[model samples]
Target: MPYSEPNSATLTPTAIFGGMFNPPHFGHLHPLQDALNLLSLNKLALMPCHIPPHKVTPEVSTEHRLAMLALLCAEDRRFCIEDIEIRSNKTSYTVETLKQLKKRTQSPLWLFMGTDSFNSLRSWHQWQSLIQLCNIFVLKRGREALLHFPEISEYMDCSAKKPLNEAQLLSLHTQTGKVVALETKLLNVSSTQIRNEIRTRNESEAKISEALLPESVLNYIHKHHLYES
Candidate 1:
């Protein structure tokens, strides 16, 4: 499933948040909204992996995940659901995905990830080539401790502080091969926990807070009997 190329002439700086949003939830959306605001990104693309390399394959089908993500994106004009990886029907590697996106638009591409994923950066295939393709943004929750990886640390550029101004972000976007850490108030929620809750608890006992999961997503999960044995 090839992605339709965007018009490069009218393109603006865009941020890509790729994940196995097995079931899209607030945890993924809130911090991304923060990134869009802090970095002054004109648009944010939510790229759901077809097959994640770092974790177990998602239990939910790709079609269902795409549908749930579509529901989430429909609420915001700036959000876009990029199905490039799902369409590929292969392992979704960030480096490869970014390379494809780069070919489609000249706009600066910003790759978003959590600090936990950043810590395991060396494990990714062709991790070294990622920074060359797009600026990497690491989002940290509260005062969470950062992992010590001197190899990655040497390339870190902390000059762009939080509440980044438009000028600073513009400067950062032009240059690649730098990692910037941004503080975000991310929710302490996990998809693993959500799946477990759904499987073990009855409907009344497994009441999912609307704050954590969107109503549309919750409804879809029940309608499809996902995460239930």
Candidate 2:
């Protein structure tokens, strides 16, 4: 469960790590760096979710999110921000995106999610087949709760035949269909926290407002007044 990757030495395999980068933060950077360091990543498509289903605040617009993501990852060649979901008008779902990503890359695909996401696997649309198309790499986000959450066990394909354990994560080499867990420290930063700061007081804005996002994104956010609105 260390931060070490279970399958980073493969032949140029790529892992798809998509998220609603409403405002890319340090927390987002950790997994990108961790996955790239731990997995045999040919390329990392940081596809920002266009329209996430359960998000409370609809998020800052897609354009703003994508632009900010681009600015943050521009210097890193291995990491990339794709408009895959943003380009589509339909609500973005993990299964649909993974299928599309599979077509785009010849390398094996690994879906990266955090422990919380994995735990709530049952709640996702088409949760069953989603786990089969590609291997999963779940990074432990925040501290592990004292309680045990086995929601992932209910994933559509989960059965006694394929248990969710460390062996399953490492079996991606030959099986190419499993889940891996990566244990890493949390950054304790979130986009929502930043937005709250901006909403609660004017001072927070000036403190972190030094081009933390892409120039274009900052312009758009200022124009829309997303969180402030």
Candidate 3:
């Protein structure tokens, strides 16, 4: 796609990638890429948070996280990182973020998530109103559930698609109203696993620790001695 210009119908759907991004790894990138292609998004605005309202994960500092994210996305114009949440609030909430985004740009926005997260839609902050704001794009995680939550298919009424490959990613776009579930390829990586490896440093896990994370993040752990402390 050509570089998007002002006052034109930019097909680039700006999918919101909001998180701590403590040190973004390949795991984060997989869904990001899958979401971009699946939703036909032109670009992704990586939203590194202030404090995630939903979870408490002691990541590197927000500034460092944003800097690393910027570094990671530097090569691609399609992926840009935003620190709006850090600038405004101590805690980041998706409901507020989506509402504020709707107020800012004309680019069509979509919220990207894993199938498990989408299934827990109603439990999020002001989640129903969130659906009205942007379409939900879910990437399948795996055959197993991380949280053993109930079978929920109502909050978004998201249509399901079982895609085994990258090309078959699910897609849906909404301009006027209502929420739709678009399906996409499931990336098989987990942040929890990454954090654990860093903390434990077992010989059996050395391969994953060396491969999955970026050198920058590894250096950060050494500098701050995160997992050690």
The candidate that wins on TM-score is 1
Better of 1 and 2 by lDDT: 1
lDDT value, candidate 2, whole model: 0.62
lDDT of every predicted structure (CA atoms): 0.75, 0.62, 0.60
What TM-score does model 2 achieve against the real structure?
0.73
The C-alpha stretches of model 2 lying farther than 4 A from their native spots are 1-11, 40-42, 56-59, 141-170, 204-226
Model 2 per-residue lDDT at 49:
78
> Highest lDDT: which candidate?
1
| Candidates ranked, most accurate by lDDT first | 1, 2, 3
Candidate 2: residue 102 Cα off by (Å)? 2.3
lDDT tens readout by residue for model 1, 1-229: 1112244324566678988888888888887777776766658889999888878888778889899999888767789988889889778999999889888878877788999888888888998787667667887777666665544423343322457765555555566655777777759887777777778866664676455788888888889999887
Q: How many Å off is the CA of 139 in candidate 1?
A: 1.4
The deviation in Å at residue 226 for candidate 1 is 1.0
Model 3: lDDT equals 0.60
